[model samples]
Target: MQVTESGADLLALLRELDDPQWLEWPTSYDRSAVAARFGELVARLEGDFGVPCVAEQDTQDSSEYGRATVPAEATVCGTRIVVCVSKFGSLALVCAENPGAYLGTQDAQEEGELDDADLASVERALVELGFTVVPEELVESDYDGPSRAHLYGQRPTWWDRFFGTF
Candidate 1:
């Protein structure tokens, strides 16, 4: 069956079934496994629909989940669908302008430098995909324990104290 860009229909289809019933979830499903799953899904979708579906894996460490973007083609609707599947069966699909657009927005958001237009576009895309996109002000609220652990080691003790003050 071919999947269309109608958010409601897509959501219904996804909610009606489970992926685990068809594919085995690896115990140690790391980034590689996620990428492989993305590739597999794209291949299946393309074969079933007989269209060109390009799948690209986002390997950035800061992302909450691994991402795969499939562009729309002649047979498919003009939608750029981003699939993010967690190791535990949880999956989210965010439809945006395109992979390049979404990634650019993400990069700006991560850097806390997103312009108003870009931010609006991102919000619109997320909302269209039925997601409650968090505001930038509230995005970094949860900071505790290992979740906030600095990937890079601390500078000087003085710099550490001055870090948040700025």
Candidate 2:
């Protein structure tokens, strides 16, 4: 039986898949599988989609076992995207226009012409790559006292936050 499926076929399979376990990491050994899948997609992103791709791995061990710090650069359908598997398992393929002023990745400054439709296309690509891509509510940082103050000029409070007050 052929297990590997084409992109459109896989996407159709994803649409029909209702099992939450579909996205779960099956075994610890699967990290390499995930990374290999990611690498294949990166090739497609660059070669088939005409997106410039750059991949940075923090370490080999990190890549093999840990969250797999594969921060990739791509331009899909005119949208310059930063495809990264965050330290957590959030596989985010965000447009590299402006991620966050202080907290976002530095590489997001490399802008492109990706619009809303392009973003949807990117999301489909992510889904095809076996990512859940759940929507998360933005949470306020708890480092309010000083780290927040230092980072965003929020005005220091009683404590210094990360380290002691200077």
Candidate 3:
């Protein structure tokens, strides 16, 4: 794949995207990174990782009905998972209770509950794929860090934090 940004730069951009105050579609820098790595990521997802998934590249804003993805899916073993790959290279892997129904993979891997070994192998692959991987501990966690503070022009209620992870 054509990598447009250094991993360090990508990481910084990812941190920028992580800002609760930041909103809007990914910047060109972020999009460039995603566009460059998308192919290799999908390959690993469908190949080495044994997870069959695709990205929704048409999302123009964060509020679209199908914001998948921005990037996520595949089944690992018996568990149905959604993998969200951000434009800046941060990756989130989460468990899905419903098949083909969106589990809101947006920026909330903490809610992701997966087998430890399984998640490890996946994170390893992601690291190899040049992604800024999130910590495994963050998955299946009760993280109350700074999250998306608002959507549209209105502030979200307490239940709406981090894309309504409930």
Candidate 4:
């Protein structure tokens, strides 16, 4: 969803999706697993970029639980960036113009000298680490989130939506 989306928009979307039971906290959600993945991701990022990794979580948000948004940040190519990650395995790289500006729930906010090639390398690292990195062009120019309709003649599941896998 867009960073500009309102709370009402989120509610509408959830209701439209029939209030997916899996979204309920402590149901299908595994907090420990999510946290562990975050740690691993941070380590991977640090190694890939040759920089220290720092992460910020969302445990204080009252309206947020069961969901993941472990954004790990670091400096690469002399530019600070935040790698937004989620439990669903979606990731986005944001130039760290503002601290904590990027999260797994929203689009990226960027303001650095990270050229396309640099961003591509970052995406490659994420993909190598087994995270689904959406093409920046599609996300920046044509993102509509995931479709519930038969995308490419197949009904989309959460797996397909986030991981590009069946």
Q: Write the per-residue lDDT of candidate 2 for residues 1-166, one digit (tens) a residue.
A: 1113453453343234312232222123355665676676566556545545566543242211112111234333333455444222423324344233223222322333444444555456666776544221111123332124233335432112211122
TM-score of 3: 0.49
**Span of 10 residues, lowest total lDDT, candidate 4:** 61-70
Please give the lDDT score at residue 141 for candidate 1.
26
Best of the candidates, TM-score: 3
User: What is the lDDT, from 0 to 100, of the residue 65 in candidate 2?
Assistant: 17
List model 4 lDDT by residue over 1-166, tens digit each: 2233344553344334322233313244566766666667677666766666667644332212122222334333354555555433233333433323433213342433344454555556666656544333322222133353422324343323332311
> TM-score ranking from best to worst?
3, 4, 2, 1
Candidate 4: residue pairs that collide:
none
lDDT of candidate 2 vs native? 0.37
lDDT of 1 by residue, 1-166 (tens): 1122454453343333323232223244466755665556556545544566655445333233444454444223344444443333334333344333434434544544334443343344434444433222222223222222342334312111111221
Question: What local lDDT score does residue 14 receive in model 3, on the 0 to 100 scale?
Answer: 41
Q: Give lDDT tens digits, candidate 3, residues 79-163.
A: 4444445433244333333212433333223454344454555555567777654422232234233653343324443113222
lDDT of each: 0.38, 0.37, 0.41, 0.41
- Which residue runs of candidate 2 sit more than 4 Å off their true CA positions? 1-29, 58-79, 87-90, 101-113, 134-166
* TM-score per model over all chains: 0.35, 0.43, 0.49, 0.46
In model 4, where do residues sit more than 4 Å from their true spots?
Answer: 1-27, 62-77, 87-112, 134-166
Model 2: worst 10 consecutive residues (lDDT sum):
157-166
